[model samples]
Target: MEEKRQTALVTGASSGIGRETAIKLAGKGFQVIAAARRMERLEELARQVQGILPRRVDLSDIEDREKFCQYLSDLPEPVSVLVNNAGYSIRGAIEDVSLNDAKRLFEVNLFGLIRVTQACLPGMRALRFGTIVNISSMAGKFAFPMSGVYAASKYAVEAVSDALRIEVRPFGIRVVAIRPGFIATEFNDVGNEMTGDLLARTDPDYKPVYQASGAGVGKMFVNATVPGPELIADIILEAVMSDAPKTAYSAGFMSKVFLEQRATLDDDAFDRFLTETTGLTDLKV
Candidate 1:
């Protein structure tokens, strides 16, 4: 018997994990709609995917929420999957980051993600089938010094994915949280935009410790990084098709270890580990 084709909507499809996931899904016979602000990149992606529809929609904008929802609602076949993959890191302490930057991070990472899920819910419920894959990060589990805002946003995403999984299971909808470790991407570079001057500033006395710690993280990414985009995309494809997919998935080498460590931590041990790893001593902020 010929099977019906499923449709997936992937946000942040112009680049990185979202782009790769979209391609993988399309290759696996799912009709894909690749949404991102970069229309030229998306156009290129559309060419690459077997049967992908490319659309330019910035997930960060609150105003476009309704329009995007309406577009998906009117799709020929109901959207069977949604990859909430558009997000960027804002590197700074909470107090050092601007309110606008914080808002922008959450607008895409949390608010916009939730908005799209809410918008897609009716259709999913009506059809009695769907999967929601949220692209969280390792920082979602462990708070790095400069990534407070970004970590908070991803933490929110992790929480939402956890709760929504149970809430929608009765309606035949599944939510999967994908926590990726540091894969080389534009996120590393673009993190500067959100941090502004704050990234360069740490406690005057703790500068050396912070510098060394940052270097360690950079070295880890450079040394142990996995293939970007396609590797993550293949995982997403598996998550969508597997009847018994794990509620949460942590991809990449360091990501799995970091998340495991975070989950299994005693407060004292975690504190000690953090202090040692970051080269911190008994210093108060």
Candidate 2:
């Protein structure tokens, strides 16, 4: 007998890991719904991935978001998977960052994710089979300077996925969180814009630290050493199809090392790791 075909909704499918994952899933005979704010890009993706439903959705808005969820929930076909991959980052010290910026970050990264999950749960429950995949970051597990708020937001996501996994286990729904270290994408380009006002207030004592951190991020972007986004796409594929997908998936070489070190490092060792990785050793804290 032929295997049953399923339907999947992927957010942030305009580019990066999300786009590749959506395409891969579609290739596997899954009817894919590619959701993102960029309609043109999504349309292009639809052409490349046969049977894809390219829907424009700004997950940041709660009301319009409901419609996207409703689209999947009401599908005559069962909605078997949801990949919550839409998120952005604001690079700056938490205290110096503007409240609005932080709010926007959380609205998209946290609130938007929650809304979609809530909207889809009922449909999944009815079917008694579903997979919810959330894209988190390595930053969620380990802390470093200038990422306090962003890390906090991802930490919340990580926590939510953990608790929800058990809560929904009884209902036959699976929740998996994928934490990527650093796959080059527009994610960093937007993160670089920490607002001029925020930059102007950077502490003179920490100038070297900021400069070093900036250079490290730039090099990481330019070097592109991490495995390509396609690797992540593959991981997502396994997560969705495997009967025993891990609760959390970590990708990239550095990311794996960082996660392992994070599990064993003391405060002093972690501080050293951050300093060496970001070239912040010369900076006065």
Per-candidate TM vs. native? 0.92, 0.90
Question: Model 2, residue 181: what's the lDDT?
Answer: 87
Tens-digit lDDT string for candidate 2 (175-283)? 9999998886777676776444445687776566667787865655564566778988899999898998999999964787789888889878987987777767766
Cα RMSD for candidates in order: 2.2, 2.4
User: How would you encode candidate 1's per-residue C-alpha lDDT over 121-173 as one tens digit per residue?
Assistant: 88899989899999988877878776778889999998999999999999999
lDDT of each: 0.81, 0.84
Error of 1 at 9 (Å): 0.4
Off by over 4 Å in 2: 1-4, 193-206, 215-224
